[model samples]
Target: MNAASPKPVLEMRGIAKSFPGVKALEGVDLTLYPGQVTALIGENGAGKSTLVKILTGVYQPDGGTIVLDGTPVLFPTAEAAMDAGVSAIHQETVLFDELSVVENIFVGHQLTNRFGLLDWPAMRARTRAIMANIDPDIDPDTRLKDLGIARKHLVAIARALSVEATKIVIMDEPTAALSYKEVEDLYEIVERLKGQGKAILFISHKFEEIFRIADRYTVFRDGKPVGDGLVAEADTNKLISMMVGRTVEHIFPKIEVAPGGTVLEVQGLSHPTEFADISFSLRKGEILGFYGLVGAGRSEVMQALFGVTHPSAGTIRIEGKTIQPRTPIQAIDAGIVYVPEERGRQGAVTALPIFQNITLPSLARISRHGFLDLAKEFEITRHYAARLDLRASNLSQDVGTLSGGNQQKVVIGKWLATEPKVIILDEPTKGIDVGSKSAVHGFMSELASQGLSVIMVSSELPEILGMADRIVVMREGRIAGTFDRSAVDAEELVRHATGNTAKEAA
Candidate 1:
């Protein structure tokens, strides 16, 4: 526990917010101190973001008192929040794509010369200095569009650095697109920022990350603060349990099935730069779990299998029928569907309504002629929504506004609407709450019971162990080892995944 002696740098007391029908937050309290990172964690719709928005002036709280450095302040706009030395780096980087990194970083606070024109040299120097302060690897001249997602995110943080934000900095899911090396770099930056006595509010779903970086932690559930305090004394397992209000024994709910009838046979599957020589057979009523560390090509292999990426040298057969699917449509036509890991990007059209997102891939089947029949689409959406237990007040709500778990359900609903025999789920439960995770596990089990072949690729070892009848470990784009349900343990899985163990049949 923080001694609770001095007034904290920033404090929110009795914070509350609500929609017309949904209570987004209820009496949430948080305090941020200098020279420490406070991790804010919870299930989706747990009011973590709502609290952040209120702090950043994106959303006005229905009730609360915000005391910053012992002074009550009400931020009416994000700009006002920034002007008061509070800034947030969102999960998705918001920068002008056409602008160069230097220009983007110093946009609002650029150095101007006596002639009232942009000082290119001074701005570039300042950008380089800021990058050096954080990470010298990033180039200032590169256009924001040319940089990868992770780099763009760093650039957004650098924007905060340029302003010398002394009070608080909020980072939302900072490691989502970062490579392992980049994550390390970010940790270094975080350490440096902490030394400067900057109060950082870190938001992430990864327990390992939170454990490694956070000094204090807080949990929110159903838009209210459930737990709060220091991280050193908090148990990770207990924290997850408290966050979801349930004991989470296993994340993977794979059946112990005797695999039969080669449902999907991948022979010599190879994709340039992603993976190669991936050969495996997913049998009917079987859940084959692919486990690997981040960037070990798990999602890439799933994408290749779903025909999102063309295999350079491989033959995929569905029920012994040789199939060469050049596109996702071809894969769907062949009764094979892929529920992508990035639900927001590949799975759901955020702008579209729930019913539209569900029936998008299978609308032709429901339509009589070229003209569409929305009534039939609604029927299908209603059936799947009920079946998946999607928590939406109305079917007309935009899929983007739904919580992570519900959005994931929407993704599954879309693919289930296709009625595919073989379904590939890549990180199916990432960023979702425990309750929603249980729902997805049950749904997967039900799908397998219906004799649907499932191949789930996940980074979480528990999910793989819990759900997979057989686990396949991959390393550097090759099948490292295969383990039957009873044979594999977490250590062995890690060994195989990290290329420490040779190809062993278990």
Candidate 2:
């Protein structure tokens, strides 16, 4: 609603899309004005991605009209959309590893000279110019794989800008994997784009990021537009209500319990390059929270404790028994289970049936004389599935077909079958919907109440403050501070996590 903003460069009206069993989008509308960032926000399955796909020509809307610059248009293919001045930079980079940075920026539309041959020099110069506009120091001739994740993202944005006629650019969850500094860099680049008179569609679940860069706001829920307005006029609570259709009463659902004896203890744990001298203790029926920024080594320490990585120097004791686990199977055998952050890759086998995924870790216990017991597997799967309130057509359905929250439940269910004494969850509710997050949090509380010690590794401050009985903040591979739940303060936790100040507590 900025009066200085130009008219809308692109508009979608009455967009509706559906599959056999799903209505992905229903009559959703959006307008993108030049020199403004319009944030598209919603839960995991709230049709944000569906709308992006429609605009990028990934899926044709069953019903809708797309207008650009006072003219109606239909993009039958992704290439057609780009040629018509609409480009999208997805969450995952689409660059080839073998290609150089210059080649990646102009891969699809290469430059040609008068002789009709590939003009490598011209492309390299153009790539350099684009890189200068963003980072100035990124080498255009470097291979794509040599750059870090942040630089790779920069290349993606530069690629979008390389299009001569690009008027609208869609960035979908661009900062999901970025570090704090990387996120700042992205915000700077977004501002530069806005200055260039380009309309940007910024899709993100992080409200902080939305407030940082977005000028306009739109909220979607269950495939329909629920709210749309200027960012200046909206607050986080208002946006949350719009996204979930109700006020989320208890996001964390933490339950108070008297701490019992120590279930797991780590002393002087060290990894060569990841973490150093990390130590913590988890009591029975307690939720221990590990808080840090991305790459602060929280996940690395969890990975080491879970046997995904070995510590160079450390002692791990479970229930007062010293043990060293060399592999994940060893950790599982010792009654320690991990729910990894990347659920799709490390947690569940998407192509496998839901029952199979749940029972995969505990197959040894359910089998008879080395032969699989199908009935036992089904029974165990049903027990945990029902406990977690997992939703699916049937237990035989592929795990890939479920939503993000359900898939996370399936991962947790698989580990719960082991009946581990201690469970480590890395970013447990990440990328899940609000309702699903509440369910997951409630399940964690239930697990703790049942005398299971939980170690939750998360970058979200609210989750740490809300759910933790004892919070440990990490900074650059070391324990910076620790505080009891009753003494928790957001500013203090953030200060420790970012190394602004260290206040180690008893």
Using lDDT as the measure, the top candidate is 2
What Cα-based lDDT does every candidate model obtain? 0.85, 0.89
TM-scores for all candidates: the values are 0.90, 0.92
**Candidate number achieving the greatest TM-score relative to the actual structure:** 2
Residue-level lDDT of model 1, residues 74-108, one tens digit each, is 99998889888897787765789998999898876
State the TM-score for model 2. 0.92
Clashes within 3 Å, all models in order: 4, 0
Tell me the deviation in Å of residue 134 in model 2: 4.7
Q: List the residue pairs that clash in candidate 1.
A: 252-463, 252-467, 253-467, 254-467
Error of 1 at 189 (Å): 2.6
Q: Cα deviation of 40 in candidate 1 (Å)?
A: 1.7
What is the C-alpha lDDT profile of model 2 across 1-506, one tens digit per residue? 45565778999999999988889899999999998999998887888888888898888999989999989999898898999999888876578878899989998899999999999999989988888867788888899999865678788888988998999999987876667777787888888889889899998767788899999999999999998989998998899899988888898897888889999999999999999998889999999999988878988898887899999998999999998999999899888999998788889999999999999989899899999999999999899989999988899989988878899999999999999999999999876767788889999999999899999988777888888899999999999988997897998888887777756676
